[model samples]
Target: MAQPNAQDDFAKLSADLSTLRSDVAKLTETLAAIAKSEGGAAADAITGRLRYGAARAEAAASGLAEEGYAALQDAKARAQALGGDLGATIERNPYGSVLAALGVGFLFGLLSRGR
Candidate 1:
């Protein structure tokens, strides 16, 4: 009787182990499927966001470039206007312009000597 009882217990333990293994395998399969599906979706979402960000950056750079070009054009126009004014002034008062230049040169010499 004792031997028969021990055999019965061993058989029950084997069945329990088999069931546990089957449950573990099913769980592993479910996890793998979930990871595969979710990983692809997450990757696609990240790629979309990156593309949007790149587009925004490109637009911002283009806008800044346009603004810089406009500013350069304005600066060139102003410099040309100032050059014309200076040329007219020099032509109108050559002697005064020469005297001013001599004075500026003297001042520069004095400042440079100190340096």
Candidate 2:
């Protein structure tokens, strides 16, 4: 049996990770936007409590998930600082990054639509 090339395996894994990161960023933006847009007082309070729970979850995440979350938050901050859209990020890296963002947005849309 032939063995897989280690470098190729790593590259594929890295791409998958990048896509996942982008997806999380999109979801974060979508959720934040949704929170801003579709909320009465009760919904606002619920979101606030959910955010509080997120802080606790952050504390519990540990290791790689924590690092991923931190990177996600950084990506989100950068997006918001640049008006929170695709243009800037896409201009920097055309294919992978933008696709990741789209994947994230798609996930967010599906989840939000369900709710």
Candidate 3:
């Protein structure tokens, strides 16, 4: 058999290099596609977690609001009952209440004068 020429060998080497470059380009495209898919999946998972956390937070805030409203209502009821009791007591002893008020004012005036 005749031996291959130098030009033939050079041409074969160039062809192999071109084939290698094409294969590398295809591999790069495939890897990029896979990474994009995985990134989307990861983002979806994070979004789900965030939504769950937000829902829990909202529920907790709603519970706290209910508790606060109950406490305020209880405080208002107590204050109203105390006011009625105070009014009855004042009506029953208007003269005594006036005397007590005058005494308190006199004491406060004396204290303000540093005497």
RMSD of 2: 40.3
Instruction: Report the number of clashing residue pairs per model.
Output: 0, 1, 0
Worst 10 residues of 3 by lDDT: 106-115
By summed lDDT, the worst window of 10 consecutive residues in model 2 runs over: 82-91
lDDT of each: 0.97, 0.87, 0.97
Give lDDT tens digits, candidate 1, residues 12-81. 9999999999999999999999999999999999999999999999999999999999999999999999
Cα lDDT tens digits, model 2, 1-115, are 9899999999999999999999999999999888777766668889999999998887777666878999999999997887746667777788888689899999999988943
Q: Rank the candidates by TM-score, best first.
A: 1, 3, 2
Clashing pairs in 2: 23-104
User: Which stretches of model 1 miss by more than 4 angstroms?
Assistant: 1-4
Model 2 alpha-carbon drift over 4 Å, by segment? 40-115
Question: How many steric clashes does model 3 contain?
Answer: 0
